[model samples]
Target: MYCYVSEVKLVSLPPILCVHLKRFRNDDGFTKKLYDKVTFPETFSTAIFAAGQSENADCLKADEHYSLYAVVVHMGSTMSGHYTAFISSNQDWYYADDSCVQPSTWEKVQGTYGGYRQRSGETAYLLLYRKKSWNSSG
Candidate 1:
């Protein structure tokens, strides 16, 4: 018997990381959207996923971490939907939908983690994280 294995590693970590969630998929010649809840942390470290000898390895410092700063949410179905953005600025959260922007809370942002039902609702489509240091001056 023959077996194969593959590994993926991060060659570099940007100051600002953008993560895209795969909520849409093609199945049986049809496009389907997944309403699976995806829990993500407000802050995350990339050191474990980085290549030890890769370029920009210095960014994997022990105190270096990424803090969630923005989230692009999609509300509706696979065919039609509206887009909104949850942005964090100056340690405050704001929700922007079209021309209307309002103050929001972290709990409200977490609600976009999607649901178990097939019904349409706000879902996190893209996430933006900014690099920060655990110590001051981040």
Candidate 2:
């Protein structure tokens, strides 16, 4: 007997959902590459997920309420690719990223998304578009 399963079919049917991503632009020649997280307190409980396929995002669960977070690596204006984040209030479809937000408090927004939440001295960021529904098994 042979058994096989594709990674594409995984994390597709998340319990929660997110929203579509927004686009950003850069006028400089240098592309800023970066990574960050949106921490969730240990007391916090929720199971959230993204629309699978993206590299940075996930679903958080606490009791019955779920909050979805999109983790993005912004490459600034110099780079090119899909730079966005999806958020959701529905509980039908969702997505998830391999990485988890740490510190459990700070809602990490990437550079691609452009935010002042980053460190007092750090620059550049990324994004993971959240979604409320998806068909892919990412």
Highest lDDT: give the candidate number. Answer: 1
Cα lDDT tens digits for candidate 1, 14-123: 88999999999999999988889998887777655653655554444544688899999999889998999999987789999999999999998998998786355889
Q: Which stretches of candidate 1 lie over 4 Å from their true place?
A: 48-59, 117-120
- Please give me the total number of clashing residue pairs in predicted model 1: 0
Candidate 2 per-residue lDDT, tens place, 18-42, comes to 3323333343854443433333221
Report, for all candidates in order, the number of backbone clashes: 0, 38
Q: TM-scores for all candidates?
A: 0.83, 0.24
lDDT of 2: 0.33
Count backbone clashes in candidate 2.
38
Where model 2 places Cα greater than 4 Å from the true spot, the runs are 1-14, 25-64, 78-138
